[model samples]
Each structure stands twice: as C-alpha cells, then as structure tokens.
Target: MFKSFAAKAIVPPALAVTGFVIVCCLLLYSVIKTDMLNDTIRHETNLADTIIKSTRYAMLKDDREMLRNIIGNIGQQKGVEQVRIFNKKGVVAFSAHHAEVNTIVDKKAPGCIACHAGPVAATSMGRMEQARRFIDARGRSIIAITAPVYNEPECFAAPCHVHTAEQKVLGILDIGLSEEPLQRTLATLRMRMTVFCLMILALTVGGVSALLQRNVLMPIRELWEYVSRTRRGETGLKAPVYRDEIGELARSFQEMAAKLKSRDDDREGGSDPPADR
Candidate 1:
C-alpha cells in the first residue's frame, strides 16, 4: 500500500514539484540578484551626482556656510553615512559627524590623488565627482563620493584672494554612507522574492497534480476495472463515463467488451461467428 501510494500520490507530483521549484528558484535568484546589483549601482551614482551638484552650487555662490550646510544635509539623507569637505589646498575644511574636521586629509585615501591631484584630475578635477566604497576609521564599510571645487576667474580681481583658472583649486567634498543599510535592504528583497517564487511553484505543481488525477488517472482506473470485470466472464459490464480523452477511451473499451460478449453468446448457442470475424 505504501509503495502504491508513493507511486500514485507522491512520486509524479514530487518530481514535478521538485524540478519546477529548482528551476524557478534558480531563475528568480539570478534575476533578483541582478536587479539588486543594478539598483545599488544606480543609487550610488545618483547619490554622488547629487553631492557634486550641491557642492558646485555652493562654490559658485562662494557661500562657505551654505556649502557646509549642504554637506551636513546630505549626511542626514538615507544611506548617507558621512560627509567631508576639503579646501583647495587639500585641507579638511568641514566634516559632518567626523571628529577630524579642520584637519588636513591624507592624500593617500583611496581615489583622493586620482580624483584630486593626478593626471586624470583635469577631467575629474571639476564638474564631475567620483564615488567608491571604503572602510572607515571604525572599520565599517562605507561609500564615499569625492567632488572638486573650482575657483572662478572673476574672483581673482578681488583684493582678498586672487582666483585665476591656474590657481583655482578651491576644495574637494567627500560623502560617505554605511553599506549596512543597503545590504540589509537587498537581503530582504532577495528573501521575499525567494519565498514568493517557492509559493508560486508549490501552487502550480499542486494544481497540475490534482488536475491530472481527476481528469486522467481516475478515469483510467475506472476503465481498467471495467475491462477486468469483462475478462472475468461478467456480462453487462459498464465502462466509466468521462468528458475528455478518457471519455473517448472508455467508449472504445465498452464497444470492444460488448462485441466479445456477443461472440461468446453466439458460440454458446452453436451459431457461426459474426461475418467480420
């Protein structure tokens, strides 16, 4: 009984379910992971662009206070872990929540020299900002955005400080955000999608199994029983009724059984077999 039940009720459905689930999970995992990676890239890029734009506006207006305020505001934004402002001379002019404000930044920090002082610095020196992930002083993973500040030519005419294009190194802004929050969000989304995909696979396999049993297995079993009864010399055996392929099969079985019965009856009475025979 156990073997039969396993064959009839477990194996086919289980195989179908297992195969479907494996494929669905693999596909869903790939798609979800790609989506999360893309989202992270897009979020980081936008965050860097936002910081650069804000910094540029502040520098254009020559409002140091506004620039400080803008950096602070960005640090408060979701996923923003830190914000640092650097003077043209590579001094840390302002830093939000960082104790090292007013100290000169180490040019050895990742991407600092490449973006602020290296040969590629011209295209990178102004207008655009670069972003990267790094470990902070606390050893926490963080995303940092670096943007350069340029001094306008018009400012050079002022007696206070000459700001020609050649001497226009104004400053750099660095924004950092903890990676934990982004990681958590992506992990949650992956879990949710995996659960959802499994649920869908379960339902699909269950529904298909139920349909196969009702529309195919049950009818075939009934037809087999009718044939067995006829083979046992039982007269007037009735085939099971159905409304699909099973129904047509049952009708054919009934016709064959009836003909055999008629032939047997004729032989018992000593009459010649039917002409077709």
Candidate 2:
C-alpha cells in the first residue's frame, strides 16, 4: 500500500500527527484533573471553616443538642457526605448520623493516624495536610477535612464553659464531601478533549496531504506524461514553468531532443543524391 508516492508522503506525517495529538491531550487532561481535585479540596476546607463558625455559639454554651441539630442540617446540603465532632479523647461528641454519636473513633483510622500515630502527636497541621480522601462503608469516595477546634479566650471565658484554660484543643470537626460531582466534571472534560483532538488531527493531516498533491505530486505526474508523449514521436510540446529541479530536468530533455533532430537532418542530407551541377 505504501509503495506509491502519495502513500509515502502522507502516511508518515499522519502517524506523527496522531502521536503528537495523543500525547498533548493526555498531558492536558492530567493537568486539568489535578487542578480540579485541588479545587475540591479547597472547597471542602472552606465549607468546614463555615460549619465551625456556624456552631461556635452552641459550642460555647455547651449545648450538645443544638450542635447536633446544626451538624445534621449541614449534612443535608448537597455534596456533604458526613459531619461529626469528636473530642480529644477520641470519643464522638455529636454526629449528623445520630447512631455514630458516643462511639469511640480508632486512632488507626485514616483521618486520625496522620495526627495521632506518632510518638509525639501533632499539635498543629497545615491546611492541605489536614485533608484526606477515603471510601466509606457504602463505597462512596469522600474528601474529608479534620479542622481542630482550639480553646480560645472567649471559649474559656463563657459562663457555661467547663474546661480549664490548659486545654489547647477542645475537639475536632470532621466533614466529608462527596467526590461524585468532581468525577462527573472530569469525565465531561475528557470527552470534550477527545473530540477536540480528533478534529485537530483531521485538519492537520488533510491540509498536509492537499499541499503535497498540489506542490509535488501533480508536477511529477505531468513530467511523466510529457516523456511518454515524446516517446510516441509527438512534437511541439510546451515545457512547464518550474523554478526548481523539475524545471532543470525539462530543460535537459529539450536539449537532448534538439540534438537528435539535428543528427537526423544531417544523415538524410548526406544520403540524398547530389543536385545536378
């Protein structure tokens, strides 16, 4: 199939273009996916901060019922998978799911191990380090943040507050957001990028093929036809206007034709009988 000039010219470029497109598209998708994931984490972080602020009054009053109700309401919002508050003792103080309340959270759990597994527990953590991704019992992917609720001046100063000022951290607010929405967005982006890649490949390959035919293939085919007609003793052939190597080939053919005609004329003159003197 590739024996023909057109195939030789077009196939290599087509394959090269295809490979280039595939590589570029893959890189683009990877960058977009990473950016989207980081955005989700930032969003979950912001939402966790909001929840802490929302329940601050209840926390100050030591009102467990009000805090639980607040957590339950936040959990009902879209993209929120779970909401729970656990004391420093690893005991669940309140949870959006009431059944989980008063349960002991294992230190080896995914979210807790990062802060508690070491000999010296982490007293503080960076924003990004505080976040984690895990699958729940229902097999749903979740991106959760564990925000530490520290004991501020206002907390210990409250009339209803119980803990002494020695407590650095009172509890932890753990909120998990569903990953389904982020996954859907990535899927859509991948589909659109695939379509775009195909379109670009077609345009690039088609354009290159058209240029080759016009600038290279057509002229060579015309030269071949000219030679064939000359072989049949045809005369008065007009040379094509070409500024490149093909033009030089055409000039050589014209010079060789002129020499052959001159030789033939000389032979005929010599063979003819001399005119009467």
Candidate 3:
C-alpha cells in the first residue's frame, strides 16, 4: 500500500522485526510467569514445612488443641486462604475452618488426585506436582499445595505409639494462597514490555527510513529532475551531484545534451551542419 520507495524498502524488515519482538515478548512473559509461579510454590512449600515442623511436637504429644490453634492462626494470616490437615483416610482431622473438621475430603480433588489417582497412593511427590491453581468461591485466583506428612521416627516412637514402621505417610497438609499479587505483577510487566518493544520498533523503522531517504531517494529524485528538464529541451540544466551510479548517468546525459546543442548552433550559423560527423 506504500507509494514511496522509502516505505517499500523499510516496511518489510520493520514488520518482520515487529513480529519477532512480539513472539519474544510472549515467550518471555510465559517464562517469567512460570518462574514466578514455581517460586511462589517453592515458598509455600517451605511454609508448609515450617507449619509441619511447628506442629510436630503437638502432634507427637497428641495435643489436638495446640495443633488446631497453630493451623487456625496461620490460616488467619493475610494471603492465606486456608490451612488444613487431612488424615490418611482422606478425613479432615484439623482445619482452619471448623465446619470442615471430621468431614471427608474429596480424594479426587485437584490437590489430592496426583497422589490418589492410581491403584497405589503416592507417599512422596515433587514440589511442582504438589501445587494446583484454582479459583475460590469468591472468584479469586488461588494456589494450593498438598504436603505429605511423613511418619518419622519420633512420631511412631511417641508415648502413645499408635503408628507402625510400615506407615510411610501419616497425613496431608493442604494450604491455599491468593494469586492476586502475582497476577498484578505479571500484568504490569507485560504492559511495560509492550511499550518498550513499540518504542524500539519506532526507532528502528524511523532510522532505516531516514537513511534510505538521505542516501538513495534523494539522489534518485535529483537525477529524475535533471532528466525531466533535459527531455523538455530546457537549457542551463543544473547537473545532479551524486557519488554513485546517478553521478555517471548525469554526466552521460550532459554530454548528449551538449552534442545536440552543438549541432543546433552549427545549423543556426549556416555552417552546413556536418552530415553524420
């Protein structure tokens, strides 16, 4: 759609660069998003480990009140959606929400399915496998991780000694956190990257266009003007100053014009225009 030579020369590379930048921006956003998510999950995993460690003594002593208070207190913290512990049988033993306690948790839920889907339950899992992203009841984005509570030596060796050595996993600690902060950060980053990419594209295209106009288009226009005046039999033609092919072409045109003018002057002087000389 461009009528100008500068547009024709500059637009294609500019468009290519634009598409490349867009793709790179999208890939960068995806990687940043994944890394941020993994970082958040790792942080939550550490928090889960801390919670398990803090409540370990209470659990070993069979102190239900203290365990409940610990879980309940953490769940009340800002950004913590919920903190609950479910027994091996998928029964909620201790939870921030009292109504959920003693209730049977759905083993098929997003947080539990990775461990419970197969015929044999998983005793351990990777950090990435432990987390799940979902929307809560209030339509807010949330990430939940299920940390398997292992049956350590202290647990089975407690005074009560209610567990066996064969028991690998004692229970599961499920913690949910809000994802709003991450989402907002990503949105801001995306906008800034878009603006930066646009600025770069403008500078690149503008620079290329300026160079083409100065070096190529200007010389060609000067040559065309010289030729147009010569074609119209105009005198006193202003020679086009060029450093390249246009310069050579202008010199040739000037020579042809001079030869024609010489033949006309000879005929006007009645000097018998030299035939084919």
- In order, candidate lDDTs are 0.70, 0.86, 0.90
TM-score-based ranking: 3, 2, 1
lDDT (tens digit, per residue) of candidate 3 on 181-269 = 99999999999999989987998799898898888888888888888988888988877877688788888888888888889999899
- Candidate 1, residues 18-49: lDDT per residue as tens digits? 67777877787778766765566567667666
Instruction: Sort all candidates by lDDT, best to worst.
Output: 3, 2, 1
Candidate with maximal lDDT: 3
**How many steric clashes does model 2 contain?**
0
* Candidate 1: Cα lDDT at 181: 69
Backbone clash total for model 3 is: 0
**Distance (Å) between predicted and true CA of 197, model 2?**
2.1
Note each model's CA RMSD in angstroms: 5.5, 4.4, 2.3
lDDT of 1: 0.70
Clashing pairs in 3: none
Off by over 4 Å in 2: 1-24, 232-248, 265-277
